[model samples]
Target: MASPLITLRENTIWENKHGTVSITPRSLCDVWNTWVGPGVSNGPIWRPGLAGLRALVAQAEAQNQRIRGLGGAWSLSPAAATHGIMVNTKPLNYIELGFRDASLDTAFSGNPDALCFAQCGASVLELYQYLEVRGYTLPTSGASNGQTIAGAVSTGTHGSAHSIGSMQDYILGLHMVIDGGRHCWIERASKPVVSPSFCQAIGAELLRDDALFNAAVVSFGSFGLMHAVLFEAEPLFLLEKSLVRMDYARVQAALGTLDVEALDLSGGRELPFHFEVVVNPYRVSRGQRGAYVRYMYKRPYRPTQASAGGSTWVQGDDVMTMLGTVTGWTPHLVPVLLEPILSAQLAPVQGVAGTPGFQFGAADLRGYVMSSEIGVALADAPNAIDAVIDVANRFHWSGFPAIRYVKGSDATLAFTNFSPTACTIELPSAGSPRTLEAFHRVWDELRARGIRFTMHWGQMMRENREWIEYGHGARVEEWLAARQSLLGATGQRAFGSDWLTACGLG
Candidate 1:
């Protein structure tokens, strides 16, 4: 018998940096670089591809190893899995999208699979760019464009808009590989039917049940390998990015009083496209316990260079300033330099920046993360700062990253889009042991508060049952079913029941 091939390293999806891990992977799946669990630690594999994956899956099956898939690695909960063969689908990052003539929904009536097909590894940024270039757009996406398509939808990512559903809403279907076997195509029964040949085209059984579709679309990698995806896209347009930075008091004042009813707005101090808050942990000692709110305004998509006399917008290069690899330098030195960098970045757009068309964060985040990030939902945006402050008080999250908000949904996989407005707190920190404790403590505190929240499916987070019950509940069951149905021929398990067992779901 031949020994299996393995890539070993202590890696992190945070800064897209390679680090050490406890176990070695036979193959990779759809996880972010910052992913961590039993079979994985630190982050996603450097670069994962199709052949590497098939060989890995074969090896795992032959060796009786459990197989699981991950994306974004954002879920702080254990849903991504702790052990076995974890596949990171990032290297499959090919995105070629072309939507059906128009809003397929109007023609099909809320059925998913109304548009183009995306390779499982495509990032939200990649998809957004594809659509923007073609004059199409996705319904919603997380603030940062780093998450992979599989990770975003599997974890039930969402965007703001009282009328739209979460990422699941736009998913017409996906190409998935199951633990028991190979890949398959999935869609809601009501949606347009895909050919059996198409299903077989990708080594999967065709499943089109509503319950199954609903469950699997946000399966959190428990179902199986998400190889490809098909989703609807809207006509391309621009969001003026009515950006606003607000104080903590104003948001709280409006919360109970409905004063801050609108999470995204332009100037009227409302209707923002992108909304976020930045928490300063140590600053609390200086009478700062809350976060700063920043929101965006939606505008038309008109391409023009800022230097060419158009409005200027910050790109990934600008945000990259947030993570400078000038290591060994005094800590203060980096932030000091960054302050001016960010300050200048905030300046109005001057050069013509073309990202597909109308959009923000055009940079692909498949491997984007300065460090590990933990996302939490806050009962009150104003009060949410304490969690970060707690971590900061402990000296974790040394370099703070801004917190972003997106109107959540009722979907099982969404992080914040719920009936009540929730604040998504993202604690960005270096993947150092010193800060891990602080991250855990802050996460535990938030969980104890009975706040109805979920962690990013792409990043590290707690995995207790309580998080699962509130995170997605029976939805996980449905997700499992969807996986089983899709992998009908192959009786397998990706990430095994670790996600379920950890959550006491099984």
Candidate 2:
């Protein structure tokens, strides 16, 4: 059989969407698409594509070069970059929508029909369209659909779904190409999904260990090349959204308490499927309309309802990009200038509804943006916000602060691992030096107040052992051990990146 097409572009420079992180790698390896022919019974349909990925790893190993799997390139951090060859996984976009009953383990209890086998390069938008047509939907996704499945899961991408956890939570299994072209299928031992035969069909060894599975799920390509992922999907559903401005005092109590009754919305009494709050730190005074509150209530999937449409003001890239550009011209005027711009852009919109796919549709490329996401326990949200506001007061902040709540994740390195629930305070701003300076101060202030927090892997962070240990503590050691066991010393060297090494994970 002919090998799948793989292209090599030498001396290439890789930059992310926000232009925050860039890498000039030795070469860029593009893993082009290869059609999968019909398989006999349970044979793997993705043999050609899988072999191509394995070859890329083998080649990297032969040259003693590090490899980093590149996806949507949506991350602001260098988590997806490497000093050696960067494999462009975009063409590895094959997806199998549902699992067969014959492919299931005898002990598996979940519905096989709801599972999806997606290649690492399959963008989240692709999965959204594929599943919606089949009357299914992902439980939760980041605010936008630009990120690939592997990229999103590796970095523990999240949305404001208070009930459901981050993207990694739905993943059932991992198909990885580790050192020396070897491949394996990893799943939780306590809750097996695919049978051993299924692993054999895919030419992968089956390892059902919870610790290994948790570590691999959110390791950001450090566990080796995540060729594909098996994730659980739910019956399709719609969301009724309401984004409006409210008095700062009215929503202040709900910021930390999460008391559903605090701020009046259409989805009253019952808990919302998604809840978020965006505040202008400079404008928060009693009786002033300084907070933008958004609530998305779950609704049954109805064929008659229009397909998901344009995104609400949930994401901050567009607004932040503009702020960043303007701040370049008037660095000192940011304190006086950003208030109206924020107030207008963050204006209220009532009774807008759509599917998760439509509501969180493709995001626009906002250049020169910087975002730092800090995850704290839901109970400490108010104090965290207070600290951020305090910093904004002292510094000329060029951006606004948005608060989102997500259920804690089981993935070992997931930032939202705060028990019960996590409140992620996202500081999206321009890439201005002044704003960047203030961003670091936010971290220092949080620590000074004795607030426990974790930083998002995909966003900006203080790249140091101290910050990582402070947030993750013993979990960092557990993750390092898992990586050490699975990849060994050789595999770790091949997959390790400068970002990981700087953070002391390497």
Candidate 3:
């Protein structure tokens, strides 16, 4: 079979918002042939199908070369970098729907209409459109729609859905090309979905293990390159969104207990589908100040003659761009300058109703942006927020903080691993040394206070061996054991990178 046309650029300078890399892909292969390369070859390859991906992994293992997959390049961290071959999975995108048959096992009793197989490179926006047309919708998604399905789940990207968990929670199955040319489809043994025949048709060995499945869901490319994912989607629905300004006390009440009814929201006693609070640390010091809050409720889908609102399609300007304009104007005056900017950015308490696809549309990438996020137990949200505000005030930092909640995820390494509910506190700011220092201080203070927290895998974090050990504890050992079981010592060495090594995962 003919190979896909592959392109290679040598000594290329890859720069994202946070870091820069002088990547050197010694040799490049753009082909979909599983057996294209001979044993002991160091050539880089771009595989467009499952067979080709497996072949490339086998070749990398044979040649003792490290490999990594790149998708969208939206991550601020360097987890995707490799010292050897880099496989660009952008061209391998493919999507399909699952079907039901009598041959299926009785354990496979899920709604067949809700099953979807999305290839590694398929972006979230693309999947949204595809599912929307079929009267299906993703249960939850990140604020931005540009991230690929595999990348989003692998890095534990999440939304502010108080009920729904992170993206990894909805994943029913994972199709992966592991080291030594092994291809397998993994799912929970307790709740098996796909039949053996379906796995065989896709040329995969079936493995129904709960721990292995949970570990691989958020492996961050360490469990080998994921070829595709099987997602369980929900029926299409509308979201009624309202953005309002509330007093700090009211916002604190909601964050403290997550009891929306206590706050006297419009939908009394009914939990909101999505809730978020954006706060200005400087303003929080004033007893009378308020924060911007957004609430979204799920509604049954209905046909309407009216077109979607303009605001729904256009996601306004990037917050990073707005903050960048005032950079270097005056560090101390940042709070004052940001007040009006934030108001303008989050103004007009208008109501909007639309499908999830239109509501959380594509994200616009702007100049350098860096963010740090940590997940803490919901009961500790009040103290955590206060500590963060203290750190911001003490350092006079220009960045602002926001809090979003999500149900705890089952993924072993997910930052939202806190049981019951977890609140993710995010600090996004213009990339600067001062901002980085402030971020580090926040972590240091939280650690000193004995506050147990986990950092987002895809965001900028002050991660070290001790931090990982302290945050994850026994789960860290379980994840490492699962990794060892899936990818043996040689495979781990071939797929691991410096970031993984620094965190003691490699």
Candidate 4:
């Protein structure tokens, strides 16, 4: 890795509407991405990869003894940073859309339980497009799919649904570079340890402890380098997504009973395949639904000319769109810039009713542009929402909306990681400093009140110093103890990163 200001310019994020946004690097050392995790210089920075990355890390290990790999810049927290060598694995992006067995059976075949061998840098959107080709889908996903599979699972990226778990829940196994970079494969504990031959086939020494394995599955970047992930996906089906404005009063009445009881607008109600609740701070006086809620119903796949018909392009676009939204322009303006364009993207929106593979909440991935600055999660859905409204009433920062909804998650870092016991209360906005200040005031008030809510590892929520203390709290200790136990010494140092220190996770 070299050092040169001019070379570093390549890694900067291109804020302009048209032009390349690449990481600036004088040499390999400066290479990084759009993500800024702990101690990282603000903005995009390119990182050298392949031998260059390993060489840097090796040198660090010989000296400072700390180096870590970073997946997607999806994390708003510092979990991806490192004082030593930081390998930007984002370029390792690739999705091998194939299967292994839903039963964890090595022999079975035939789209066996919709599965994919996702690389360390493969984005969720990319994985989705790969699955679409084969007519398969994952059980769930986060609001958007910009995060890499490795980052999403490691950080416990969550979607709205409690019945299922976080990104880790669907992850059936892992392929990682271990001590001295020994590639290892981990799966749900097996009866006989995957057989010596099979273990060698995938290049790993098998381990079978439920506690350690589970903890490490969602271990964030603190775990060793993740090269690939084996996730269990669902059958290919269409998700009939529909958005409706919700009534604040009715929502208040149905808050507790809503998600838990199901029975949305489709009669006495039942949970849709997917759900989303968007709160508008400016809507207090407006007569729109309390919050815009969307529901998705599952259906069999059927392709047409209008549909991409099992193409990778859909997911590819979704990835770029996810990244673009973070810049804070209305996603609704997609037609203005991208509607007529044809290019590679994971999740596609080409004015088609539905694609052959499937669909989920907020089908219009393009219409949801949002800024990356504000991210906050309030614990106890009902309590969090009330507190938000109360604060808004007091400060008149009602223009910003507090999005609500539930998603299934079991990731150690997911805000709603615990079921029944967890529900997310997020505050999202594309606004001015005054409105943002109002948000902070309320967030601080709730923190003082001791409301536990896990913040999204990606998106906003990265600035809260006491985030883990308030969100993970007791569970944090349990996970830390469990993680320490799982990633024992000899290899623990390699797994440790600045990300942990930033979140007070070490």
Among these predictions, the greatest lDDT belongs to 2
Provide the overall lDDT of each model, using Cα atoms, as 2-decimal numbers: 0.51, 0.84, 0.76, 0.52
lDDT of 2 by residue, 365-437 (tens): 6446788889999889989999999998887677678899989889999999988999999898877777789
Q: Which stretches of candidate 3 lie over 4 Å from their true place?
A: 17-48, 102-104, 285-288, 304-335
Give the per-residue lDDT of model 4 (tens digit) for 1-506.
24212112223332211111123222223332233334434321222222233344345545646656666555544556554445666666656554433334554333444556666777766666677667666777776555677887776665655566567777767766655555566765532223446555554677655655666777776667776677656666665555555556555544544542432465236665555455554344446444555455555776643232233333432322443443345433332333122122222222234542334222233322333222233235566667677776676632333343444444555555555434555544323454457656766766776665556654444444476667566667767776675555645676575556656666
- Return the top candidate by TM-score: 2
Higher-ranked by TM-score: 1 or 4: 4
Clashes of each: 77, 1, 0, 52
Ranking of candidates on TM-score, top first: 2, 3, 4, 1
- Which is better, 1 or 3, measured by lDDT? 3
By lDDT rank, best first, the candidates go: 2, 3, 4, 1
Ten contiguous residues minimizing lDDT sum, candidate 4: 14-23
lDDT, candidate 2, equals 0.84
Q: List TM-score per model, in order.
A: 0.70, 0.95, 0.91, 0.72
lDDT of 1 by residue, 98-185 (tens): 4333423343553333366776777776677666656667767655566688877876665443335457766777766665345556
